[model samples]
Target: MAAKAFQPRHQSVSRGIAFRLVSVGCYSVMAALLKLASEHGVVAGEMLFYRAIFALPVVLVWALRSGGVRALTTRRPWAHLGRCALGIAAILCSFQALIMLPLATATTVGFTAPIFATVLSVLFLGERAGNHHWLAVALGLVGVAIIMLPGGPANDTAPLPGVAVALLAALGTASVVTVVRQLRHSEHVAAIVFWFFASSALVGGILLLYVGKQHDLQTLAILAGAGFAAGIMQITLTESLHATQVSILAPLDYLQIVGALALGWLVFSELPGQSAILGGCLIISSGIYLIWREYRPQTIARRNLEANTV
Candidate 1:
């Protein structure tokens, strides 16, 4: 009976890992497509508009499939709005960084989101950080500093503006994560996902009036692919979280850096400098350790028990 029971859990975990890998792959491809679109003269705002617009149908379909239209309904409209706003900012900054910086550099810097999230949680969520957490955060920041050091091996004419924007994106992402943590208390996942696309579409549409530019067929195709990939990434990530403990999924997020590096080399003929590689290693190590600490066996057991009860 014990072995039989364990089999299903093992299968679920395997499926979750697969889904998370697919999610990371999708996001990497989407970033590459967005970068291609930018090369063809598509501005960030237009890309955002198309991405959000094309993603809406997918999000809606998913929401309906999950629980009909009622699943999209939410009492926390303002919270959704705030989440969307921050998300849009993060997207815009990230898109700009994708165009302006090398893929590896941009991705390495953006990986600092978790570090920023930890600090923000302490400040805003009134969460107490233990010594281990602080050490992890400090190490992660050091990693970021190494990557950002001017004229470092990784600094191959990487524009200061692009680096700054990438950091801003990381900060925005951290903020969004913090907000979503709060929203989970009262909002459904479907509602949060739906509102984000809707609000992004609205915001992107308005911004298009000023920053939009003409695109050829190739650029249009790339934009559409980016949008589709974004939608798939979001859905797969959600499904992965549902199937496995977040701690199990968190480390998999680092797989994105591998994907980013591979895509960068294959598509853009770009390579990361020594600094970037070293810093990326640090960031990944710190993040994995932090996640390990946060989700130790006891904590996982408690969470599992609570989840079962709920």
Candidate 2:
């Protein structure tokens, strides 16, 4: 009887994992598109503008399907605003880092967001972490230290600003996710997606007016591709999370570094040094450990919820 109960849950978890892998692939493609647009002289603001613009229509269509156009309202406008601000800041810093560093290296550093998120959840959400989780977070930091060793980007150049920005972005992302978790049952997924895009587009447009330059037709086309890819990647990411626990799906995000590395090698010939690889491995190991520790219970809960709902 126990085996019968567990078998289907295991299968569901496996399916979620497969979807997450696909989501990671989509994100990799999106990152590559962003890199391509950046090379063509698109500022972070312009890229963001296009991303939000393209995302708005797609997200609205989703919103309409879920509840028509009227389904777009949110009682928590402040939450939406705060999330938009943090997300936009993160995007700008990340894009700037992409401009300066090897894509792979930047992506590896950016993966620190999960560790940050885990920590923030404890403080903000009052979620408790086990000793194993603490150990995982510690190990992740040590990995970051390895990446930021003496004569490294953290110490050698102005890369600290970018890194700091990335860290803040991670914190903001975690906050957004926590908020979403709180609203999971109350808010429709389409509503959440729509608000993010609409608020981001409005705010991004304002920012663009100050910093954006005119783009050539070719450049505009590249930006459009970036936006399209970003929207698709986001949709897949959301779907993956809906289908699984954050603990399971979040770690797969580290794969973005691998994608960035491959793209960097083939397109820009930017090879990461040995230290970066070593540090990245350590970081990834800790993240994987955290996922293993956290996901089991989350999967069980999700399976139970589904069973009860049915």
Candidate 3:
């Protein structure tokens, strides 16, 4: 009887694990395709255009299934606009970084988003922080330094501009996370997601006019595939959250570095440098510590509330 009672939760956790794995794979595929597309003369702007336009149908279906027409409506237009704008910029920066650096290097650098989010929460949300916050931030910087400093992993290996762009992308991504926290108070999740896709498509369309050109059929197919992968990544990622606590699933995200390293090696003959490995370790450790610090209080408070109710 006790075993039966635990089955449902076990199933939910299993689903979370499955969905998270698929989400990671989809993201890796998208990144690889984007990188490949770039190699074929596809500009970052054009890739954005295709990715946004193609991802629309998938996002729309998910939105409708979740909330119907109501999901498309939002009371916070300005907030959505801000999120979409930031997302677009971050995505473009990521694409550009992929062009300039090896996949593993870019992936490792991109992991700084959580650290950035922590800082943003302290600055904008006025969230109080303790020693862990400083330690986490410091570790993050050190990891970046190892990758960017002379004789470090990137030591004249990858372009300096690429590293800078990747860091900016991480900051932009963190800003999006901060904005989403505010939006969650007044907006529907479905609305927030749907509108972002719509906005991306719109922005991509405008950019397309300026940078679009004819491409080989193979390149076009890859771009389309990248867009589909992005939507699938979003869908699976959402499902994973619905099934389990995000903190439970987020640590698995580091697996992406491994996949990126493998893919980059297989496809482009790119190898992970010593700095990349060492720096990635520091950043990852800091990120996990931050996640633990962020969640521990909530877990404790919930337990306290449950005990009080009993």
Better of 2 and 3 by lDDT: 3
TM-score of each model, paired residue for residue: 0.92, 0.84, 0.92
Clashes of each: 0, 0, 0
Tens digit of lDDT per residue, candidate 1, span 1-310? 0111111233378888888999999999998888878888888889789999888889889878866777777787898888998999998999999989998788878888888888998899766678988999899888878887788987773667887899999999999999988787677788888889988899899999999877788888888899999999998888887677778888988888898899999999998888888888998888888789767897567656866887
RMSD after Cα superposition, model 1 = 4.7
How many residue pairs of model 1 clash at the backbone? Answer: 0
Candidate 3 C-alpha error for residue 223, in Å: 0.5
Poorest 10 consecutive residues by lDDT, candidate 1: 1-10
What is the alpha-carbon lDDT for the whole of candidate 1?
A: 0.84
TM-score of 3: 0.92
The ten-residue window of minimal lDDT in model 3 covers 1-10
Q: Could you give candidate 3's per-residue lDDT for residues 1-310 as a string of tens digits?
A: 0111101233377799899999999888899899999899998789788988888899889878966787677787888889999999998898889888888889889999999999998899867678878889999999988888777655755677889999999999999999987787677677777788888888888988998889989999999999999998988887787777666788888888888988999998988778878888999898888888876767558656866887
Clashing pairs in 2: none
RMSD of each: 4.7, 5.6, 5.1
Per-candidate Cα lDDT values, in order, are 0.84, 0.70, 0.84
